[model samples]
Target: MDKKDLRIVFMGTPDFAVASLRVLVENNYNVVGVITMPDKPSGRGHKIQHSAVKQYALEQNLPILQPEKLKNENFIEELKTLRADLQIVVAFRMLPEVIWDMPRLGTFNLHASLLPQYRGAAPINWAIINGEKETGATTFFLTHEIDTGKIIAQERIPIGESDNVGKIHDELMNMGAKLVQKTVDLLLEDKVDAIPQEQFFNNEADLKSAPKIFKETCRIDWNKPVEQIYNHIRGLSPYPVAWTELYTIGEEPIAAKIYSANKIQTEGQLPVGSISTDNKTYLQIACMGGAIEVKEIQLPGKKAMKIDELLRGYKFQEGSYFK
Candidate 1:
């Protein structure tokens, strides 16, 4: 079958998914339709905001469906009308069996981590938080269980020592885009050789899950090792950032979000969460074995700023610490 003749229905919602959809559309693959989340109110104004996928789909003049409920009979009927030969999912919510099984060639998803590991909603973040030196992307056919399907293709990339979630995210986004295109071509030519997830690991206990991160998940535990704390901060950096409560001798605890920090090996002993600073150019938080020198941070109702800039205007009380 020619590339232009294959009818593809693309499903995604965030910026991560846009790269794959854009690659397909720009390369002239037949994207028959796009399915994204419904527009909803955002920000203080409560103005309706279209998802990133929806915005791009509009720019390309592609057909779009923003269903409130995927299993609604009306929505299913509408989806069936698309006559999709295949469907591609990226950074989207889980679909019902009816929806995933609707297409002829079946649905495939672009997962951020190398499969059989980090299988869940937030793979990229968890991989970094666990201090893995390597991670990658995977394309797999959808199945009954989430992220348990047979893999179609896998691409590996190294995680740099200082790479944050935002950096790794963009890298995988572009790499996954090419992988999507490659998967489509392989499927079109009937040359795909998919492998089951079970083949990659022996014991189920060896597998690590990337469960959805919550507000509490981003909280920094100052008692942990400095290396662990550093990884935690970078893993959630630039969004849903790792945070802590700054405590002074006789005032309310102030909440602060840490965006960037470096682990420091020191000989000076201090209790975990103790504050160490020059009150002008640096702010360091003591942890097990060492400390973390905060590089970028944000306070409530204030923009993110470098440590020096923040310290210039804001004074850390003499006995201030973090918890």
Candidate 2:
């Protein structure tokens, strides 16, 4: 137990990961090294891309390792040279047994969800998609199973009706930074007290799992309740948004992406999944119990725009219905 001074190896690769890393650096933690994913080409040109963590690490002048394979002996040897007391993993990929077991104080992770629940790659998106009112960040020891580890500390945050994945993502990123900083303080002072997850779940059953998101999963189900539908859209908003086909509010069938909308009531002659418009002020979609006013949308082959902007080039007939 190295009280007052602890050598840590920080492992992560995304903007989310950088949040924790930044806190560690700012708080004067003894971060011996950083391990992140290898650079890969992405986007239109598919040119090589340095990860957000890599860019931050470079700016901080922290030593970094971007091994293609975690099991590579050369990489493993290099990692051993860091002689870290603890290793903290954020939003990076899974780790190998050899690597995680090397640190003296053991490897820990900063997960997006409360854990034992939503224990997968896309916690923030799934939590919103599932309509959870409260979700949070957690710190725990790393085990063979992803996101299943001994509990260290967790901080809960409220999920408002208006909160989308984009909003929650930013919230968690900031929360994770503070959590990591506090976790490091605990590590340095030898005050960390880990509790086994099994104890907490001993009496509680029916634990939920957060799974990865796919393109097909992004499809909106108009048949479901409008509240559920609204949550689904917000959960994946601004990225892999829930989409459906609608023709100019009620015209020809065209694919449209709905980013933000609110549920509202409808009157007589209103059909489920129908569109109603003033053609001047509003474009609303009828639902099972109510109608939702479209705030932001994107039609096929066009950039996302507000209702006012979408109305400029595209026209929606009054009393027309959407499928």
Backbone collision count in every prediction? 0, 1
Against the true structure, whose lDDT is highest? 1
Tell me each candidate's TM-score: 0.99, 0.92
Q: Write the per-residue lDDT of candidate 2 for residues 1-323, one digit (tens) a residue.
A: 44326888999988988989988888777788999999999999999999999999999999999999999999999999999889999988889889989988899999999877788889999999889999999999998877778998889999998999999999999998899888877876778998878766754456677788898888877667777888888998988898887744434677888998887754543667777776666788877667778889998889998988888788865555555
lDDT of 2: 0.85
Candidate 1 contains a number of clashing pairs equal to 0
Instruction: Give the lowest summed-lDDT range of ten residues in model 1.
Output: 265-274
Regions of candidate 1 where Cα sits further than 4 Å from its true position:
none
Best by TM-score: 1
Residue 223's lDDT within candidate 1 is 89
Give the alpha-carbon lDDT of every model.
0.95, 0.85
